[model samples]
Target: MTAIPLSWWVSVATALFVIGLYATLTRKNAIAVLIGLELMLNSANINFVAFNRYTTPNQVGGQIFAVFVIAIAAAEAAVALAIIIATYRRSATVDVEDIDSMKF
Candidate 1:
């Protein structure tokens, strides 16, 4: 069996990042934006693991960093969802453009 190249991993990560960025910038729905953010975070995790695997096979720094990123992503998702839900309750919609103010 042959091991995959680092460049391949990088290419995949780049694609994921690009798609995520596009979704984030083009989507008008809060849920879609959140999904894009998650995709970006996942791509970062992939890069971290790939670099660690290629540079320091014996060390786990990359995996550890990826784990931290996952934790942070979870926290961010929870907080963001809470905010979105609150906003929806107030405005009856999740469209980004429709949410123009912070006033309740």
Candidate 2:
């Protein structure tokens, strides 16, 4: 069985990151931005695992780091969603352009 090449993993991660970046930048909705952020984080996780597997198969550092990233992403999503919800309640919309002020 042939192992997958590092370049392939890197290419996939890069593509994912670009798509996420585009989505984050182009989307005006808060939920869409959050989805993009999650995609970007997932791409990073892919890179971490891929590099770890290729550079040091025996060590688990990469996986550990990926786990931490996942944790952080989850926490960020929760908090961000809470904020979005509150903002929507006040402004009646999730459009980024409409939210010009943070004052409540």
Candidate 3:
């Protein structure tokens, strides 16, 4: 089996990051925003792992950082979901604009 070039993974990671940014900015629903955030985080993780694999010196920094990122992402997801669920229960809506009650 032929191994795919490192550039391909980098390109894919960049694409995922861009798409996630767009989605996060354009999305109105809370769930969609969360998904975009998760996508961005995963893309970063892909980049870290790819770099670790491609590094000639085999430094453990990238892999260690990737693991840290994954742990943080998991915690973020858990907390975010809890907040979303609580907000939805109180407001009955997940739309970002609909939840804003403070007036300027």
| Window of ten residues with lowest summed lDDT in model 3 | 51-60
Q: Could you tell me the TM-score of candidate 2?
A: 0.95
* Count of backbone collisions within predicted model 1: 0
TM-scores of all predicted structures: 0.94, 0.95, 0.88
Q: Please, what are the lDDT tens digits per residue for candidate 1 over residues 1-104?
A: 12798999999999999999999999999999999999999999999999998999899999999999999999999999999999999889999989987546
Q: Which of the two, 2 or 3, has more TM-score?
A: 2
Give the CA lDDT, 0 to 100, for residue 67 in model 1: 97
lDDT of 2 by residue, 25-98 (tens): 99999999999999999999999998898899899999999999999999999999998999999989998878
- lDDT at 21, model 2: 98
Select the stronger candidate by lDDT from 1 and 2: 1
- Scored against the true structure, residue 13 in model 2 reaches a CA lDDT of 97
With candidate 2 superimposed using the best TM-score fit, by how many Å does residue 9's alpha carbon deviate from the native?
Answer: 0.4
Backbone clash total for model 3 is 0
Instruction: Encode model 3's per-residue lDDT on 13-98: one tens digit a residue.
Output: 99999999999999999989999999999899999888787873357788899899989989999999898899899999988889
Q: What is the C-alpha RMSD of each candidate to the true structure, in Å?
A: 2.0, 1.8, 2.0
